[model samples]
Target: MTALFDVILPVFLVVGFGYLVCWRKWLTEVAVDGVMRFAQNFALPVLLFSAIARLDLGANYNPLLLLAFYCGAILSFLLGVALARYWLKRPIEDAIAIGFVCLFSNSLLLGVPITERAYGAEALVGNFTIISIHSPLLYTFGITAMEFARAQGQNLPLGRVALRALSGVLHTPLVIGILCGFAMNLMGLAGLVMPDGFWAAVTMMSSAALPAALFGLGGILYRYRPEGEMRAIALCCFGSLLLHPAVTFGLGKLFALSIAEMRSAVVTAAMPPGVNAYLFAALYGVAKRVSASAVLVATGLSILTVWFWLGALP
Candidate 1:
C-alpha cells in the first residue's frame, strides 16, 4: 500500500497542481495551449520514442495482450452507438461522437506516466502496443462510420473517406513516435546511447510531457460544464471508468494473460477520455458539448477510480 502510494502520489500531485493553477487563473489559455501543443507535437513524441527505443522487445513484448483492452474498445464503440441512437435519441452524428468518447482513453497523457509509476518502464511494452494503435483503430472506425452514415443520404466517395481516416492515423504524434521507435528497434539502435549533453536534452523534453499534459488537462477542463444532455455524458463516464476496464479484465482472463499483463490492460483501459475526443467532436461539430463534458466528468471521477485500481491491482 505504502509502495503504491509512493508511485501514485507524485503523478496526481502534478495533476493537482495543474488543476489548482487553472482554477486560480494563473495559467491563461494561451499559455496552456502553448504548453499542451508543445507537449503533444514534440515532448510526448520524444518521450515515447526514447521509451520505445530502449525497450528490450524480445522477452518483454507480447502482441496478444492487445486483445484484452481492444475487446473493450470494440464493445464500447458499439455500445456508444446503440445507446446514443436508441437510448439517448441523438442523431447519428452525435451517436458516433458518443461512441467515440467511450472508445478513446487518455492513454498518452495519463496512461504513460501512471503505468510507468505503477509497473515500471518494462511493463510499457504492452502499454505502448495499445497506445500505438489506440487512435488509429478507434478514430478510423469512428470517422469512417460517421462518414458512412453521412454517405447514406448523399454520394460521398468511399475512397475519400478511407483517405481521410488514414490521414488521421498518419498525423497522430504518438503513432509517429511508435513508428520511429520501431524503426530504431529494427535498426539495432535500441542499445545505442547518446552523449551526455544530448541525452540530457532528450530526458528533459521527455520528463516535461507529463506535467505539461496534466497542466493542460487542468486548464482545458474548466472550459466544460455539466450542460446540454447530461444523461449521455453520464453514460460516457460510466463506460469510461467502469465498463471499459471491466470488459478488458474479462478478456484478459479469456486470453490467459499473466497477472501483471492483466493488471496493465485493466489499468490502461480504465483511463478517462482523452481531450482528443473532444477535439474530434469540436472539429466535426458533432456532440462537442457532450464530448467535452464527458472528458471533464470522467477525469474528475477518475482520481478516485484510478486510485482504487492501483491499490487493487497486484
Candidate 2:
C-alpha cells in the first residue's frame, strides 16, 4: 500500500492532471505538443545522462540481467506480432505496431522514479542500464521488421538497414546523452568535482523530466482518439499490460538476478506502453490509431497491473 501511494499514485495524479487541463481547454493542443517535445528532446536526455554518469556501476552492472530482460521483451514482442497478424488478421504494418507497443515500456516517465521508491535510490543504476539501451534496441528491431514487412526482397540489405537504423539512433537526444554519460564515465570525469551550478542544473532537469513527461503523456492521450481495428488494440494492450511482465519475471529468475534487481525488472516490465510507440507507428505510416489506442488502454489498465506486480515482488 505504501509502495502504491508512494510511487504509483504520484505518477498517475500528474497524468490525470494533464487530462483535466486538456479537457478544460486550459492548455491547447499546441501547447501540450510543445511540452511533449521538450520532455522528449531535452529533459529526458539530460535526466538519463545525469543518472548514468553519476553512478559508479563497477561490479553492480550485470550482463546476464540485461540478456534476460531483453530476451523476454523480444519474445513478448514477437508473440504480439504473431497474434496480431495470424489471429487478429491485422496488416503487416499494424502487426509491427502491435509488436512495438508490447515491447516498449514507459520506463522513463513512470519507471525510474517509481522504482527508486519501490526498491531504493541504488536501484537507479539498474534502471539506467535498462533505460539507456531500451530505445535504441527497440528502434533497430522495430524498424527492421517494418522495412522488411513492407518490402520483402533479396537479402534485405541488412547492413544498409542497420546503418540507416544507426543513423536514426545517432540523432536522438536520449542516445547522445547516454553516450556522453558513458564517455564521461570512461574518462573519469564523472568523479571530478563540479560547481554547485552544474549539479543544480542537472538535478533540476532530472527532477522535471518525469512529471513533465507524465503530464505531456496525458495531453497526448487526451488529444488522440482511438480509431483502428479493435481486436488488434485489445491484443496489444494484453501483451503490454500483462504478458510482458510475466515473461520478464520468469526470465529474471532464470538469470539469477538479485532480489532488488528482480524487483526492478518486474516493476519496469509492468509499465504501460510509451508514447513513442505511437510515434513510430505514425512515422511508418501505419497502425497509428491502433498504437494510440493501445497506449491509452494499457495505461488505464496498468494501474491494476502495476499493483499486482509490486505486491508480487519480494
Candidate 3:
C-alpha cells in the first residue's frame, strides 16, 4: 500500500501540475515547445546514456527475462492492431497509430522512476534493456507500420522507406547515446570516472529530464483533448492498461522471475502511450489525430491504473 503511494503518486502530481499550468495558460505552447525540445534533444539522451553506461552486462543478466519482455511487447502491439482493425473499423493509418500507442510505452518518464522507487536502482538495468530493444523496433517495424498505413493503396518505396527508417535510427540521439554507453561498457572504459564537475553536471541534467518530459506530455495533452476520439482512445488505453500488463505478468510468472522482476515487468507493460507515437505519426504523415488522442487518453488514465496495479502487486 505504501509502495503504491510512494512509487506512483509523485508521477501524477508532476503531471497534474503541468496540466494545470497548461490549462490555465500559465505555460504557453512556446514554453512547452522549448522544454520538450530540451528534453528530447539533450536531457533524455544523457539519461539514456547514464542508464546504459551503468548496466553490468555480464553473466548475471537474464536473457530469458529479456526475451519474455520483448515477446510480450510484440504480442501486445499486434493485438492492438487487430483490435483497431476489426472492432474499431478504423482506417489502416489510424489502426497503426493505435497499435503503436499500445505497444510503445513511456518507460523512460514513468516506468523508470516508479520501478527505481519500488525495486531499487538495480532494476534500471532491466528497464534499459527493454528500452534498447524497443528503440530499434520503434524505428524499423513501428515506422514501417505507419508507412504502410500512409501508403494508402499506393505503392510504397520499399528501399527508400527502409533507408529512411535506418537513417532515423542512426540519427536518434538516444540511440547514439545508448551505443556510446554500450561501447564504454564493453571496452571496460566505464571505469574511467569523469571529474567531479562533469559528473555533477550529468547527474543534474539527467535528473531533470523525466519530470520535464512528463510535464511536456501534460502540456501536449492540454493542447489536444480526446473528446471526439473517445472510442479509439478507450480501445488503445484498454490494450495498454489491461491486456499488456496482464500478458506481461503472466509471462513473468511463467518464466519464474523474482517478485521484484515480475512487478517491474508489469509496471513497464502498464506504462501510458508514449509521446513518440505522435512524433512518428507526424513523421509518417498518417493518423496524427488518432495518435494524439491515444497520447492524451492513455496518459490521463495511467495515473489511476498504475496506482491500482501497484496496490495489487504485493
Worst 10 residues of 2 by lDDT: 185-194
Candidate structures ordered by lDDT, highest first: 2, 1, 3
Is 1 or 3 the stronger prediction by TM-score?
1
Candidate with the greatest lDDT versus the true structure? 2
Model 1 per-residue lDDT tens digits across residues 1-314: 65347765677677777777778889887887888888888888888887776667776567667878988987887898899999999999999889889999998788877888877877666777677667667777877887788778677788987887788777888778877877876666536655679668889999888788877777777777877788999889888888889898887878888877876788899899999989878877989989998998898788778888777666
- Residue pairs clashing, model 2: none
The candidates, ranked best first by TM-score, are 2, 1, 3
Question: Candidate 3 lDDT, tens digit per residue, 212-254?
Answer: 9878767777877565467777777887887788778777878
Model 3 scores a C-alpha lDDT of: 0.77
Better of 1 and 2 by TM-score: 2
Tell me the spans in candidate 2 whose CA falls farther than 4 Å from its real position.
Answer: 154-156, 189-196
As for candidate 3, its clashing pairs are none
lDDT of 2 at 78: 94
- For all predicted structures, in order, the TM-scores are 0.91, 0.94, 0.90
Give the per-residue lDDT of model 2 (tens digit) for 1-314: 77678878887889999988998999999999999889888998888888777767776578877776787688879998899889888887888888998898888887776787777787777778777788878887888787777767556676777777778777888888888777766666536665789879999987888888889889888976777787887887777778888888888888888987787777878888888888888988788888998898888888878988998888
Model 2 TM-score (2 dp): 0.94
